[model samples]
Target chain A: MNSYPVTLKQSYSSALQAYLADAQEAALMRAYELGRQATENGLGVLDIAAVHQEALTQVLRPSSPSQETLQTVQAASKFLAECIAPFEMTHRGFREANAALKQQATQLANLNKELDAFAYSVSHDLRAPLRAIDGFSQALLEDYLDKLDAQGVDYLNRVRNASQAMGRLIDGLLKLSRLTRAEMRRQPVDLSATAQAIAEALRKSQPERRVAFSIAGGVTANGDPVLLQVVLENLLSNAWKFTSRHATATIEFGATWQDGKQVCFVRDDGAGFEMAYAGKLFGAFQRLHGRNDFEGTGIGLATVRRIIDQHGGRVWAEGAVDRGAAFYFTLEP
Target chain B: MNEKAILLVEDNPDDEALTLRALKRNKILNEIVVARDGAEALDYLFGTSVISGQDAPLNPEIVLLDLKLPKLDGHEVLKRIRADPRTKLLPVVILTSSTEDEDVVKAYGLGANSYVRKPVDFDQFSEAVRHLGLYWLVLNVPPRSKGR
Candidate 1:
């Protein structure tokens, strides 16, 4: 009887050791299935522990049973039961967590749909009144010009200006929301050529401004072309706007190797901000400069941050007052 | 002088007035039939509703369709217009304040001849109306109407 139990326990132990040694996920699953089968066939945890103790006792004493051996078996049984309890609890916890995660994902998807619909309606509805205000004001200026005084005309123009500014704000908000909702398509994009083109357009728009652009050759990235263009537009436009006061300005676009990864940068000799306010740079409507100083809706940098984030990239700026600013970004290789 | 009447399908009274002003300012003096809602627009086009009587202008030169309306939407109206043989080839321009990409793609997919986002500045809006009126009313040739 001692020999039979010893051989059976040795075979089971060896099988378990072989599977554990391989450490394959499938093998562990197989082991779990075997464990379940063994338990279901009238072999409880206590019985399994009793078998282990019997195997040890058989190995120690080849032919005879003793009171000392029985005591040892009881102690081993209690210890094995305690060891197995936590694993069962952990398995139950994992199942509950997975189910909860699935529920949350569904809720998130529904909320996104609701948000898209809300944005669409808001974009459509909000602009109508703005157009009316601007349009009617223009009408007053045009039709009632003979009867109205210069002050009246100025007031109407101010109303038109305010409404148009509001229109721009609404457009900016819509663009930001749309960026969040838009699907991204990734491909290798010629970022240098894109920057050069935008720079050329800026130059053409204001030929009197002597701004030199230095774009690195073959500087490319993997991202959605349209979104990347938006990024370049925002960054380059900022450079253009801030450098307007300078007699001559320089804007450079290039990439450098940092931490074994490629980091692209846009450097501009423009009106740089204080380091203390840098934290608020990428927030929507966060303007470091006064409206009188810089004409902006303050949505451009926020949009740039959002686009880069969507591309699984990072963006940061380094600047000092009147020294100029440089923006650096990185994408996954 | 252009004999074919133009259809201005807009919901908001303010927009309607502004759009009419824009057209007048641009010297687009073609007869314009105004529809306040998508349902009324469809009725005017298809002559299927109680309001579609002898006075309704059926064969419009161009349809300036707004996306958001009180009773049916622009998409539904465009779909009905495209589905019918009589109005299938009629030039329909999507004139709205929405610069959304989805709206543009959907409008084109639904067989819109053109899409123009209404500018907030009256001067720009007037210029856009002028170009639209000049192009659709005077320059572009229309397909023969069914003469219902």
Candidate 2:
């Protein structure tokens, strides 16, 4: 063996030496960093060698029997290999968790896209058959009204009415679907003005019906103005329809402070449903009354429920059969 | 009375017939030019395509545009109409079956003069059409025809 300079020899971790051995001579000094790290971790030769082969090989380079470098690098590498198992396990666990989360996110995104497509198809497909029914019924009435007797005319009328009701149902479904797809814009809405406008519209719709309205001033809520209008319109219209037989009908719009939050209410002296059906009140196409008693698509309350839910609110109804129905809805903070 | 004609751009034959019937029923007769789609509407207004057969000026009093059409939707048509300085101030009444909040907001934001939703009820639809036609034809004065 040739004699080496006193300061020329050094130890290395196996991994560091392995890397340096594959690299050029210029990379050996930089690769020695792993040996220092292994030493700092209190690793012995065999453990470091198994974990960091590159560093050990470089430092153990047998140029001219550098006995000092060979012994040091081998010891450090052997020591480091044992310490790496726990760290590697923890890293692998994290990698698996990350991969799982990514997969779940992709699945959720796909589900959302599928739901949107389904809504679109349902809305489009349902409208076509409804239109045909309405169109054909009207055509029959126009073409064969003279050939048919009173009974036939009545049958046609019923057919037309049923088709119209179906149309309303389709429209309601579409509205709900659109609401789901729509981007909501929240702003401060003047409840009093909104109520007044709805009241005015109701009055215009039935000029002969004398229905008095009371909207308390300074009542406001944060929501989409257009959607809130729909909410108010449905609630008020329901009140009006229910109270049609009443000699004197009164409708009130106001809000009350409940649990430190404003809970708005629409109260009317109208034909309200029994309390037993309250559970199904917000279900789509769930009507509490017979079609002959009061005409409705049964989706009004469902629409209201969806709107309230979107606004982060809750809706509930309180009333008896012939007394009055009051709907209370509150938006969350 | 402005000599400029009113352009009724509608695709459905039944809807077109009903609209014409309403206009006639209202008795506020102005020279009406009906185009079946957005393309035809543009052609009539620009004096291009089939409108070249007639010697009348291309300027229209108002454009009654439907949102949903077979070829070229209403929004794109509205954009094109607004982009041209010649038709920029033209009043476009968006008469459509869409009563969605987004549709209303978009039509108004696009500078539609009026946005009327088509009532599903036959009588109500007819009345709306009549009133709209009368208001645009007789009551509202058209922009000056000096440019054309």
Candidate 3:
């Protein structure tokens, strides 16, 4: 009957309306969860978008859907899309930032490699001409000694000395650059034994000088033996050199606990530097004293700083002018 | 017996002059043949060019080779000399200005009889040359030549 058909249509419309509401609620919940998960996992925009499209399809695919149901599905899909817009933008920003960081890392590595190659070539090429200059000066001195006056010979000697000093500078520069390029191998190094040996050598070099050395026994550190030796040599030699003018100097190589960390120090009773110029102490070619007053290339402390930095350590100096200086360094365990 | 001859392979004219002067100062007094580059050195040793067109090939007692050369590096030249049966045991000494550790290890690995770093100090250089000449030319006897 016509009445029965109308009743049946009414019931069907009510059921479809209820089903659409439930579907919309469930889809919204799922979308909220997906957005949360995407944000947590740092999921890409395209990946979340694909997942969202699949979810929308599942939500939209209904058996015997009416015209009103189809419209609701379209409306729900648009809402879900808008909901994910903020997440998509955030993911895009993260991806771009990560890419930029990777690019910067690669650029830094390439620049370091180029610097190493430049240093190597400079060491090789520069030494050749320097050797030539020094050698020819020697030849002139030996062969034409009688032809030239004493003043002329003295000038040639000065030239030779200057070239030799330049050679030492080049060698120091090469060593400093190599420290940056060389791979570090860490092991337990006997700091006490190394310090004692260096002190012995320094004493032997100048037997006339009376310097008391107190090296702490059983002091150990984890670092490259060769590099650590270089560090000690520079520190101890600096101590020895600066203390030369003293009537009797005392150099102490010891380690003490400071702030729950082992701090190693090289202390000397000699001509210390002013606190004002302390900032310039570790810079390459930075000399507090005149070249005439002290013979040095001023690259030693710079090399020390570089080596310590490579070892993941810190170094600093403390002193007053004309007073003794104490250099302290610490290595990470 | 004819005084033992020496082959001085050096490309840099200044280095060549200094080496020659050092050798003379050390009183080496041996017949010295100067080759300007690696190719010329190979030519002299292998008897392949105008320098080696005589009836008999020139056989030097020792070869003082510089590392950096024009055509071939000292390592490559050393490898070739070691590969050849005639010059394999020719007492080749690597005499160069390179202080690089890799150069030293490579030279020795390539079967170099001696690896000497050319000192910057002329006096030390002369002293090193004196010791080298005394040791290689006079003290240590060379393997009998195949031609001999």
Candidate 4:
């Protein structure tokens, strides 16, 4: 049917004329229905007021008696007030919702500021004590080595190792937080080159691991280069770590079509996790493997998920116990 | 006072002791002048207060400044150090635990000669200080002080 302000104007004129001619309750209900229909047709309060003014000029002619004109004006105001009632209620609803939304926004802004201060203190103040623990332990090992027995020396070494491991954990935590807060500069990023660079770094880190890398060329994306690098580094490094036990292993980096969209993937024939534990993959510090099996702070997949989420993409995994694992992700805007 | 003493501006006693030991191990045997806070650092460098017990500012060979300090912070101290004509060209190296990008930007913007995060691993921290000492003190030449 026709949905226009012209329809509203015509309906409003007829309703007012009917009400003036009959002076009945049914006529007043028509005036109310006209107001509701005008709102539905996307007409504003001013538009309805203009329609009502036009109707009044034609209804009240100068030839009518002055006393009769007074009565007609008063009676017509009753119908006009009923018509304007719906518009006032809608405006009131808008004001309430707007105020509530503003209040929620203010609360969120304050929470963000507090989180920034907390992260700053954690970065600056917390490391000093950890450094002192590691530094003093080193001093004891260097200066009092002759005084301590073999077992005592071993204990000191353990203390130093524990402190250093804690240092690594703190560093990892800082890195994750920093990446989330970092400013993103999105551009066309070369995913193939990014994956290749990470693979090279991993190979150089452990030259004895006889791992084969099958990275597809021309894999590209539109995302923040630095953040996309983090995603590839985490996934590839995880692949490299899980495959350390094998004398020789193969890892692949490529993309494929999924539901009519391009999806990037990293797959490895490594110590793949069971499908039962796959639900815990993207959580921070979530690990399906034991520490002795693979040494990690359990932040790699979590970091990858965070970056992908910020890019408005989704990440998922598929694996079978000891068979292999494949990670698929998409980058949109 | 006339000796090319090294001024160490630090707040934490542990870091102060650790840094001193690191420097001494590197054979940086210059006379060390330690200021425990930013205000004391300014007092020693400008003779702003009688607490330092020097008649004039003790222009050290280098100032190893820490960012987080009591009474005054590192950035404000660097601002004042660069503001004064006598100490404007003084070499100030920021040594702190913060690797935050904004802190790095602010330090360099305020005329910091170098920025180094105090590594948690003592071996790496020791090596970093050793190279730092050899580079800034032995190799890098200091300009003649304008306050002279």
* TM-score of each candidate structure, all chains considered together: 0.80, 0.60, 0.81, 0.80
Q: lDDT, candidate 1, residue A236?
A: 92
Poorest 10 consecutive residues of model 1 chain B by lDDT? B48-57
Better of 1 and 2 by TM-score: 1
lDDT by residue (B61-133, candidate 2, tens digit) is 7888988887888987898888887788899999877766777898888889999876555555658878887
Q: In model 4, which runs have C-alpha deviations exceeding 4 angstroms? A: A1-113, B1-3, B49-51, B146-148
Top model number, lDDT: 4
State the fnat of model 4.
0.83
| lDDT (tens digit, per residue) of candidate 4 on B39-144 | 9999998886555686677687899999999999999999999999889999999999988899999999999999999988899999999998999988998888
Identify the runs in model 2 with alpha carbons over 4 angstroms from their true place: A1-156, A181-276, A311-333, B1-5, B28-32, B51-57
Task: Please give the ranking of all candidate structures by lDDT, highest first, separated by commas.
Answer: 4, 1, 3, 2
Give the per-residue lDDT of model 1 (tens digit) for B2-67: 476788899899999999998988888788889999988988887665545665447788999999
**Greater-lDDT candidate between 2 and 3:** 3
The local lDDT score (0 to 100) that residue B43 gets in candidate 2 is 84
**Model no. 1, DockQ:** 0.82
Give DockQ: model 3.
0.61
Write the residue-wise lDDT of candidate 2 on A127-196 in tens digits.
4455445555665677688898989888878877777777677687777777767778999999899999
**Model 1 compared with the native: what TM-score?**
0.80
DockQ of each: 0.82, 0.12, 0.61, 0.80
Off by over 4 Å in 3: A1-102, A257-260
lDDT of 1 by residue, A1-333 (tens): 225444446655655565646877876775576567554453445545655565456554634758787677668777887787676566557767977999998998789778867876887688888898999999989998998999999999999999988888888988888887878999999999999999999999999999999999999989999999999999998999999888999998999989987898888998988989888999988999988898999999999998988888899999998888999988773
